[model samples]
Target: MSFLEKPRVLFYLLLFLIFGVYLSTVSRTVSFGDAGDLITAAFEMGVPHPPGYPLHTILGKLFTALIPIGEIAFRVNLVSSFFGLLTILLIYGIIYKLTKSPLAAFLGGSFLAFSTRNYFLLFCFVYGLALTNHLTIVFLAPAFLFLIIVTIRPSLKRSDLQREAEPKLQAEAKEGRTFPGSLKTFFQELFRIIPPKIIGLGLILFFVGLLPYLYLIPAASHNPLVNWDNPKTWYNAQELSGLKRILTRADYGTGRWTSTTASVIPSGRPAVYQLLFFSEMTFYQFAGLGVVLLLLGIIVLAKKRNWIDLTFLLSVFLIPSAGFMIYTNLSYTDSAALSALERFLIMPYLGAAIFIGWGIKSAADFLKEKLPQFDYRYFAILIFFPIIFHYANVDQSKNYLFYDYGRLMFDSTREVVIKKDDKAVAQPTKA
Candidate 1:
């Protein structure tokens, strides 16, 4: 029996129920910041030519047309909610495909659904920030997905890249014919136990995975997650120069030293003298874990020497993180990487999660060889972190506001319309 069929249905039904309840009772708190702006842009413009978010604004406006855009709160929040669910499902699909661990996938999905990061954005985060959450989930999930695809192929032997292994690994590659030496084994592991002869459908989903990154276009107009433009909040992207440039840009038209520090701290030196630019975003510890896994996977790859695991690790984790590091040096605020590049690079996270889960499974397997006490129960404990984080996130769902607790964040009066700030205008357009 397929475990996914039942669990996914249950999850979907629960998501619908919870979302319906949230909208019905607490819908009053539904938000509109950046996403509303995108929707507004969509109504004003069409495909390929929306103001900022060509992806979200167009999509959100189209959807809202079917529903009611009358309420800024509900419409915007719902759009993100829909994509958020898609992300959860996508994660499951990747885990199932990559790790072949349905239990791990279920646990991973539960953890993501209840994470504090997601919770704060969905419930309490401000408008634009909350909408960014959609991007985070959308692109991140797919990035992980494609990374899995790319890495999975290499895990098989060279001949398997085109043909099937002797047997099917997952249900998909059931019809492969195996021949040759190491080549036969490689074909079996990537797409299926046998080789997956089909391509169109998988290819579509793989490319479809990248669509969420479009929101970054309009997102740049503002400081994104942190108020980097606010001198106080610069370096939110983990670049010292980024903070300096952001405030410098904010000081447009007025060259006041207070507004723009220019040479305030000298090049090659930090303005604030901190260890790193961002907090809560960098995945130093986790990345380290991935590095460790890569070294180990390389050893396992000796006989198999699967480039997929190695590529998955290097490309997903190292590449993106390295990109952020480079941005820190070259110093372009417009192009400056997110401080949370490590987090946003969800491919790495997926790999890490897979490897970590696998490590748990492997350890359990090894211990089982020695002692009977070690079993899936040990892995169950390993799965609890994300689950607890997710649930804790949901409990405080209503209080989180997408952005900060400023008047712009929650203007209950409705009289204080935001026109002075283009970003303020952009907030509700796509939400």
Candidate 2:
């Protein structure tokens, strides 16, 4: 169907277009953090530092060559924006599926995908792939798992009980208390209720999604401008790919905590410290009211028995926010890295934003029923709030920091090299 036929489709397009334009305007030139290495690798068709981002590099190379707009960096930046938009689209689809209200879904999805802000995935394909575009994707696993369990747990238990009681029921068949169905029919019914087939398919798709890692092998062999820990051989490739890194994550001196380490109170700090920290991040992402609305949304979903969506959002929220906080043992000494971890909290922010949308919808529905004459369209104005909040916080359209920063770095390095060269020239005769 044409987009106009579906309000959700139109709203998705509108959100994507607006965000795409904004991201393009703020697109960096030289690079930001790992972005510089990523751009260079992509431009030269080389591998990036450690477990190279094969998919990002390959796709970036194609965009740099073919996009026919702006400089190489700008083109790569556009690729980021493009994917950013796609992520927004995905968020909208997910929210719409839950809320079944176009307006609510739009606001919620926009808040998560664009408003809160956010990654590249292929080094060590599992982690890299998971983190390639956005590390928040990892939150999906917990969310999906929660949804699966919540949706099927009761059914599974019921099926098990029925199976166990089947013999008794069959024995009583002579007394006319027969089993509900024949053995064949019972097996068929049990199969229908079982979630393994669907879960198995999901697992297959998840692995298939990692196929982009295959590109790394070929890209590594070519040896481009910036190949870190060059993965020319299979052994080197695996090493660079982060297989060891994942296993030896503890060796990196990173204070990563997991569910197992949940008991060890870091620095003798109480769990309340983590809760407050989580609260602060959530408050920052969505104001105090938004957090309340998120809780309210959970209540609303529970009331409606929306187990699937509730579990999904809980997964997204808990995995990244609570899960990370439990496992990632950050210290007060490193305010910088801890601040960066705040960025990872975007998953919970996303989950909260979604519930905020639902909360808005539920409130509006209730109010409209109470006051039948009141125009519910007034609630539409709240949509502009998220848009305005996002634009105000994120707008860097006129910032030329990337350019100035790159030039400064280049000049400083050149001067150092020149000084070293002069010192060598003066001393070389004696040698």
Candidate 3:
């Protein structure tokens, strides 16, 4: 078999290639936005902003302590690169599983790895670093669901089963079976289709994932320097309320759907503007060719009657894009807020990249039929387009703006003093 047929080899090759690119561009010091705060929080085992990312804090602490290569901030930045790479690999794996075309997977994965937004802020200390950007990570949910359903019920065609059972159900009804009996039979079939153990295991693992949130309580109780919302009290009259506020992001005024007072979306702008902005961002991510492939991929899936995979891609893409746009209602004019909003598009772009892979597979299959002499593997060269186009813009190896600014701020502040609400002042100290 050709090397393209060996997915394991291709997987490692992709990993190596992307790792080199990421390492070359990763920030050597603290980045903008929450980088300084997150690095400090992780280093001191403290908390950052609202929803105090306990899992990221814990993991960042481990990365900072274990990786002795760079400054403390650089180690934390590396954490983002690590997860960004994993996210790319997951997209590659998902595409390969869907298309069974290694070339297609490579192109899709590389497209995402080289995208400008991903490299600049994604692999940096901003939202994409340390999985604090839940929007990007949430896209994995549909991918996981798709894999689980495909693996567990690959041969269990729901339509065929329904058709086969319908006649039996009618016969049973004619024979005077009661409504309750039919309902019981229906549940039995449902349980048979999805075993109880699998459901129980899924629920158990979900709750286990919640275990990390408990870390916030103790971390806050220590009165860490970066603690937000101070969710330390758990047993008093305010039991868990503070923690609940942090977790629910009450400080940011999230969770309400129609909260006009809390919405950041400008008043004159309609909800449809969010959808338009998302489309514009989509076009920016992949450019013309990539977007074409994405559309073609959707068409190919629909033509092939592949509802499951199609739905999976659509869910991941639309939910984070259109769904979030409508939900968050963030204003488009605010550059800072918009910049933050753009990071959330990483997951949607992942979905689009997978579709691009499917489109490539479809195109290659057509080409093979039309021209037998043509080698489809040459299509993999397309991966270099983004790499070449984005290299100059995305490279962050020498980017030290954030690092220098942080140092300057610290050095400029001589004899710093702290005063509490009670007017208690700590002794001044020289910088």
Candidate 4:
């Protein structure tokens, strides 16, 4: 196929199928809880402290003002669904950039877009706004990935740094004598790694510098997650504490004990482990097997000294997943109940995928060189299997999947609008 001719047709065909499912699943007749509240909060300009998202509220208001639909519910969710597509596209672009292979990129975007959690949330539910969380994850994942690629992609050479550092050296050359001793060493190393003139005149953008902001974006300072300043609601902290205690525990006694199936408390997170350390959280929890693959992948990336695998390790180890491990193992009672481990780390999922893709591709390429015409198409299929599996699991009648933010908007005005008269009434002056 020359990696060029007609693959995008397949890519977009997949996207259309996803969109079609989303369109068919919207529940026009029945409205639900939080989805309606988001719409309501939009017109009213705010929402209850602990769980509200101001940026999301502002977006909801803008949609309602323009659409003028009787039910703002489906409309609001549709917006996040659109961003979900944007997330998919961005991943597609980045994966293309990382692999220089169109098929790999398509597979990467497909995996992310159809990730069971991502798919169910983006396509199946009224909680269109809820998809924003993963959209946030997918979106910044690329920006962070871009940052990584930009920082290291072309592999900066020492000669290039010397040329860029020209002006400062010119000053030293002109003087033909000792500049300040402290300044001499500084510029020497500066000239060694970066061009002196460019270092002074322009900013050197690096991965370590800009990435912290992704984590900070979700913190929402000034408009803190809760009104911590007010003492009357002080016990809101305690309420969060109590709620965590109740829901996080695993009671095998709960759920169906007899229905042809059994559920366990899941003392471990297999996927988190598998994706990070080479051990599946549960299914492939064998000793030493995963560790060897983990080391082999690490050695491949390390031999090349590439940051892709390192970033994947960080995402797997440090970035918080929307799963039970964070609630149970990484608990910090005072923080947002579900958001304790670090949603800020969410910025790196794309980078994680990129590095993992590169790591796998690079390893396979090296082995193929030794194996005499080893075909790697099967490797591609296996890597993409996760995406296919996720789509199947997440395609549960689309309506059941999302968290329903429109339900928040639907009732915002009724729940919050003030009923005061238009004209101002005069009050007596105090002596």
Ordered list by lDDT, greatest first: 3, 2, 4, 1
Give the TM-score ranking, best first.
3, 2, 1, 4
What's each prediction's TM-score?
0.49, 0.73, 0.80, 0.47
Q: Which candidate is the best by TM-score?
A: 3
Off by over 4 Å in 1: 1-36, 39-51, 62-70, 111-304, 329-348, 375-378, 381-383, 390-396, 399-431
Instruction: Rate residue 177 of model 3 by lDDT.
Output: 82
Q: Candidate 2: which stretches are off by over 4 Å?
A: 1-13, 119-142, 150-204, 236-266, 287-289, 305-308, 412-431
lDDT of 2 at 31: 40
lDDT of 2: 0.59
lDDT per residue for candidate 3 within 85-149, as digits (tens), equals: 88888988999998998889988898888886786443335445433435345545766687778
The true-versus-predicted C-alpha distance at residue 321 of model 3, in Å, is 0.5
Q: What is the per-residue lDDT of model 4 for residues 1-431, given as tens digits with 9 covering 90 to 100?
A: 64332457646755785577545543432233344444444545433222234456566567667876645655555555666676666766765665565655555555444443343233213233332332223433543565666675344555655455556667766777445743775567657556677665545454443343232223323232222112222223533322122122111122211112322225566455424422232112212222233344456667777765455554543344333243234323324422322222223343444444454556557667998688655454543455444444544344432335434533554444443321111122222
Off by over 4 Å in 4: 2-14, 21-36, 48-52, 65-70, 123-303, 308-348, 359-388, 391-431
The residue-by-residue lDDT of candidate 1 on 1-431, one tens digit each, is 54333546535643664455334333233333333334334444322111133455545555557776444444545555566556656666665565566655555554444444343234212222223422223323434676656656555565744444333433234434333433545543544633475555777786775464334334444443322233333345544323344333432332321112122223665422222432223333332332343344344444356665555554554434333334333222322223233234433344444444344334445667898864554444434454433453344334435433444554653555443433223232212
Off by over 4 Å in 3: 120-193, 235-241, 254-272, 416-431
Winner of 1 and 3 under lDDT: 3
- Which pairs of residues collide in candidate 2? 51-123, 51-240, 119-133, 120-132, 121-132, 121-133, 124-241, 257-327
- Ten contiguous residues minimizing lDDT sum, candidate 3: 419-428
